[model samples]
Target: MTPLLVGVLGVFGLFALMIFRTPVAFAMMIVGYFGLWILEGSRAASAVVLTESYSAVSNYSLIVVPMFILLGNISSAAGFSRGLYDAAFAWVGRFRGGLASASVLGCAVFSAVSGSSVATAVTIGKVALPEMKRLGYGDSLSTGAIAAGGTLGFLIPPSTGFVLYAILTEESVGRLFMAGILPGLLLMTLFISTIVLISYIDPKAGPRGDYVPLSQRFKVLGRAAPLLAIIALSIGGIYAGVFTPVEASAIGAGLVVLLAFGTRAINFAGFRGAVLETLKTSAMLYMVVIGANILNPFLAVTHIPETLGNALVGWGLGAYGTLLVIILAYVVLGMFLDGLSMLVVTIPIVFPVIQQLGFDPIWFGVVAVIVIEMGMITPPVGLNVFVVKGVAQDVPMATVFKGVLPFLLAMIVGLLLIIIFPPIATFIPDTMFG
Candidate 1:
């Protein structure tokens, strides 16, 4: 029938396929290609698909994706997570709920290299969960803290999510990376504060257990020097304009390799494993990118996003009300869908509405990320929770979900803070890239 109706049906059908366990990339590509062919003759639609795929994939800016992915893969294999946790533990393990706080800091540090939330959750869980449980931390707090902290992987600098968002929205990659720094640190602080508050309320949740002596703590600090150096150099260098995003990723990757090699942590097996995993992950991501390109034009043809935006803007709701509605929608959608899929499916509609309301895209990116982070911890389909659960099969799923509640509250606060004060997301990018 009508083009708009066809677009509507296409989106629903694609989601239905995804619900039935079809791979997201394949589902979108298949629907998009056929829809375009139906809308335009087969030859013309096929040509459009080929051209979009090439242009999207061949852009030099996209090299950052693989380089950053390789950086994360290499660092993970090299045992950076252990060093990161140990360092944070050395400094904080003596404080109240110290182990839990260390988990947050460790996730933040590890995220600098790993950049993938699931990887952060899984890696840090392996390193932090055992110690937290051994130290008599409650099951809910221990599991929940790690699960919530892992999401910082996507918010912090060198984030894979940010990279993908930038590519899709045509925002500056470097600026988007810079935009993440403050919000990431602020959210990490919120998580830490949540742990302290919880522990304070019920000391039983996290027993002080024992305090390491200052002299011994210094020794623990020495063990973490490698991680500190890598984080400062990579993130700091990028901010200082010392390197492009791709170059910074490359440098980060190289440094991690050398450090891992020097420490004897990364051997032949680890090196090979890192490379292979990187290739596979990179390939999978590119495939998704290719699929999005195929599907996006078809969605545009439908004009549903435009129609929806106009309706929202036409409503008497002020900008703040509109934003609140969007965040609520994200939280609800997050319960059932993964963050990347949500982004691809919704940004076409959301971005235009947001821009029409006089908000900056970079600021909106930060806001969108925070909303998605909430989804990562929420029920029914929280990716980070499942990741932690997979590693912590002994812990009940409900306990893990319950523990992350405070952090989820904290994420909501973080989102509000950014919304009320846009500079929280824009200050760094404005100062550095303006």
Candidate 2:
């Protein structure tokens, strides 16, 4: 059989495995292993798996994943996320749809530490949803805000998306993280603006909230200061060249651990739970990374990415036209695939095209991550929407999906602005790393 045919079969087998409920990690691993065995010898295939698996597990830069996850997990366990949420509510809960706005803000803040959308949504939803409901905030608006806000975790600093993108493309993690800073904040602002527009159109949908006095607001802010400080020091430190990503992760994790125990926020049991959860998440991410690494070499041997890049550029579309096509394809893919799966499956093919078109990789990373974040809330398989529905079980699934529509549009707007003005995503990274 021709190598091109082998590549085609391998792609189908990968999808078939996913269809049959094989874990994405293992699905990629299996296709990669046997694809190599067919093309190379069995000995080479076996060696590739072992070497790649070990390489993935032992990579020094990857320590950021586990440490950052630990920081977020421990912060949640210690109830620090609650303090952050309350502070947000205190400041913004008085305006029309302020509760919803505060939820988005809380998600953005918590995302700085958590870096996982589900965790951010769950953490904020638990604290924000009940209050919004209590204060007569509409389920659609409130739940939608949290659901969309939670995706900030994918774009903010220390993002899992950036980490995976870096790993796949061999880009600088710090530059990618810095690149996301402005765009993440922009998306967060757009989400808030959407809430304001919705509330204005249907004030009853998100009634105005009670205002807190200044002294009381500051008091609540004081409660949230520790986590905020840690977020600043860890993420800020990275931007300031004070620490590498690995050191920043360790410092952030260590500080959160100390804050948890030192303030009596968590007992031994809670600490254990945080550690266990971190291990599970970190292990899962590591496996996906390993799977991608293995699968990529196989794809290269098949020359699929090269072939695909050639095909895309050969379509006679100019650079921007090709990019538009790529973005549209991602939107379609996002409807069915989760964010991590999309990143792993598509970036190898897409990254080459991106480079060919002369788009900045860091800027495209932000663009790609925002698109993935949109997928997290897109219908048919909106992961974050499902997560929000899970949290607000009394709220109908349809309502949750309905709620995210405005935010979804807001994400698209943010995406367009970035595309039109690439500097929104590139300026910070360029200034910092230059």
Candidate 3:
């Protein structure tokens, strides 16, 4: 068969494996290895697998993955997420929809330390959902806010999504982290605004929270100070040029561990559990990286990206039009695939087209993550929605999906603003590094 035909078949086979409950990393690896064997000789394919596996594991930059995961796991085990929620509630829980807004703010703050969207959703949901329910908040607003806010984990600094994007595209990790800051904050604001608009339309959906005294607000802020300091030191150090992305991860993880021990928040068993979880998460990410590396060469051999890029350019759509098509594809695919799976499978094919269109890679990284965030709350396979559903067990699945709709619309608006003003994602990186 022709190389293009082989590439097409390989894509189909990969999806089939996913459907059969094969892990994404292994599925990509199996398809990629066989595809390479067919295109080249057995010897070349064997060498590719061996070398790619070694390089993926040995690459020093990949250390960021496990370290950041450790930081998040440790923080979660130490109950820092509760502190973040309390602080946000103290500050924003007095207005209409204030509890919902506090949930969004808490998720955004916790996301700075915990880079996983599912974890952020689960952690914040367990804390905020109960409070909202007890305070007479509607399920739609409460669950919707938590699910939508959880996506911030991927867009904010220290994001695992950004790290994976950087690894796949060979972009600067530090620059990508910096690029996400403004956009992350923008999305958070949009989420909060969505809650406000919803509550305005139906005040009973989200009643005003009891007023918190200044003394209590400051006290809660003090409780959350350690987490705030860790975020500042790690992400702030990157912006100030005091640490590389890898170094920042190390510092962040180390500090969180120390804080956990000093505060007696985590015992030895809890610490060990955190380490084990980090290892498992990191190993899974490494396998996906290896699979992507092996598949990249096969895709290149078929000239599929070039062919597609040329075809799109030949169709006479302007850059923005082509981009719209790509974004729409992501929204559709997101209904079937999780964010990381979508990223690993599609970037090898779509990134070439993006580069050909003269778009900034850093900006695209932020934009692509925002699109993935939408998938996390979208129907059929919305990961964050389900996570929130698990927390709010009495709330129907449809209700959670309905709750996330406004936030999804808010995300789309935030995405459009970024697309229209690319500098919103690029200015910090340019000013800091240029």
Go through the candidates in order and give each one's C-alpha lDDT.
Answer: 0.86, 0.93, 0.93
Candidate 1: list runs displaced more than 4 Å: none
Poorest stretch of ten by lDDT in candidate 2: 14-23
How many clashes would you count in candidate 1?
A: 0
- lDDT string for model 1 (243-335, tens) is 988888888888878888888988998899888998888888888788888888887777877877888878979888888888889989999
Question: How far out, in Å, is residue 245 in model 2?
Answer: 0.7
Better of 1 and 3 by lDDT: 3
Count of clashes, each model = 0, 0, 0
Over the stretch 37-136, how does candidate 2's per-residue lDDT look in tens digits? 9999899999999999998888888899999999999999999999999999899989998999999999999999999999999999999999989988
**Candidate no. 2 TM-score:** 0.99
**Once all C-alphas are superposed, what RMSD does model 1 give against the true structure?**
1.3
lDDT of 2 at 402: 92
C-alpha positional error of residue 361 in candidate 2 after TM-score superposition, expressed in Å: 0.9
